[model samples]
Target: MEYDFTLKYQLAADDCDLDQIVERLAEAGCDDATIGVGQPGRVALVFAREGATALQALLSALEDVKQAVPSARLVEAAPDFVGLTDVADVAGVSRQNMRKLMLSHAAEFPIPVHEGNPSVWHLSDVLTWLNTRGGYDIKPDVLEIARSAKQVNLAKEARELEPRINQQLEYLLA
Candidate 1:
């Protein structure tokens, strides 16, 4: 099975140059990796690899990124998925409100791409809706910044919650 993983790194808020990191990673044979504008002061690295090769590829990419930006520290790593709270945070609303909005505007809200205990949506789809919702009138540049912030917050929250969620799942399964 092909397992995909996203790794979040703590980047220095002042001197983090993502473009340089990308160039370095590319030179290191991790050309497929991407640096996403995460949170107000962080960046995220995403990798997709298959089987036994996955670990080595991930480690290689991590090493490359760290070399490029010495301040980089692995924050969290996980399989791809975005949670409801992430959507809510991106939308600048409470989770309860987001839930209500999704329910009432079911036709307009993007469907969850990953259906699990928390039901997650694709970041792109949710960002699209957040940027272009009928009455909100959010500008593109503003939305871009907002999207980055949301991504950062979402990644952090997901990392924080992963263990707790796994424990709950284990309890339920048992």
Candidate 2:
């Protein structure tokens, strides 16, 4: 099954020209990918691919970007949902500590987008919260993995709904 993923990279240098990077990526086969400059001088790269694991997608994306923009460095790739374990890892804390921090700041912490055994929150939101609180340094590789996972999940969901959406359209046209 195909997966959708968004990988974020931090622009390594302040003077790095984004326009040049975008042109390079476009020429290197990531034409459909998105390159955005976000909070804390980050360049977020988002792409969707099918037929490989999330990690594979991440690697492929990185390879593509490297080919286009050798200096651009990915900084974050957190998926839409991440368990406490992953969150804690990103936050550089024990899972238990992460839980305690969440509990202590219940009102402020971004609520998980999805609730389950290990509730997950959007990578951007979580990192923003943590960065604001001066708790952790959001890492790029971690975000890349999260982005890949989230993309894959999104792709799967989209694929599942394709048939129904087509049927509805056909019915309306008929």
Candidate 3:
């Protein structure tokens, strides 16, 4: 299976030589990716990689980038964070319809990761909710990739959390 995803990284000052970094990435098994460096000190790679599973594809891409640019810090893994329009596009529904569904099922709807302006959600959460609701045309591959991307992003963010915070939230949230 081929999983498509994007990985954005913040490059250390020393690793800003775009040409050299591209060469290194190509050499490091990322020849399959399309590299973008429009922003200073940032690099984004869109990949279509073959793997046994979406998780395998994402992890392998992360490892390849790590080898290519050790100083690069992951900023985000994409197809994970999104807005209603994004969710609607993937679910084959109109943005208004998605909003309606959310408003109607406010209590049962999955909570957004960020609540304000145009709220954002983990794509997988919305997809799963729609899946259970039925009548939504959710592609298996898309749902799988979105789920894998969510897991990867959460794990990356988890590395920064204090262990004590988990202990603190465990009881409160549960």
Q: Which 10 consecutive positions of candidate 2 have the poorest summed lDDT?
A: 149-158
Question: TM-score of the candidate numbered 3?
Answer: 0.95
Model-by-model lDDT, in order? 0.62, 0.68, 0.94
Identify the candidate with maximal TM-score: 3
lDDT of 2 by residue, 1-174 (tens): 344567666667653776776787789878657667655556776676543465786667768877877766555454666777777776788989878888999999888877776576876567668878884777655555555555655554556677889689669879
Question: Model 2: residues >4 Å from true position, as ranges?
Answer: 38-40, 80-174
lDDT, candidate 1, 35-60, per-residue tens: 68757567776655443444454555
Write candidate 3's Cα lDDT for 32-150 as tens digits: 99999999999999999998988899999999999999999999988999999999999999999999999999999999999999899999999999999999999988889899889
lDDT-better candidate, 1 vs 3: 3
TM-score of 1: 0.40
Q: How many Å off is the CA of 30 in candidate 1?
A: 2.6
Candidates 1 and 2 compared by TM-score, better number: 2
RMSD of 2: 14.5
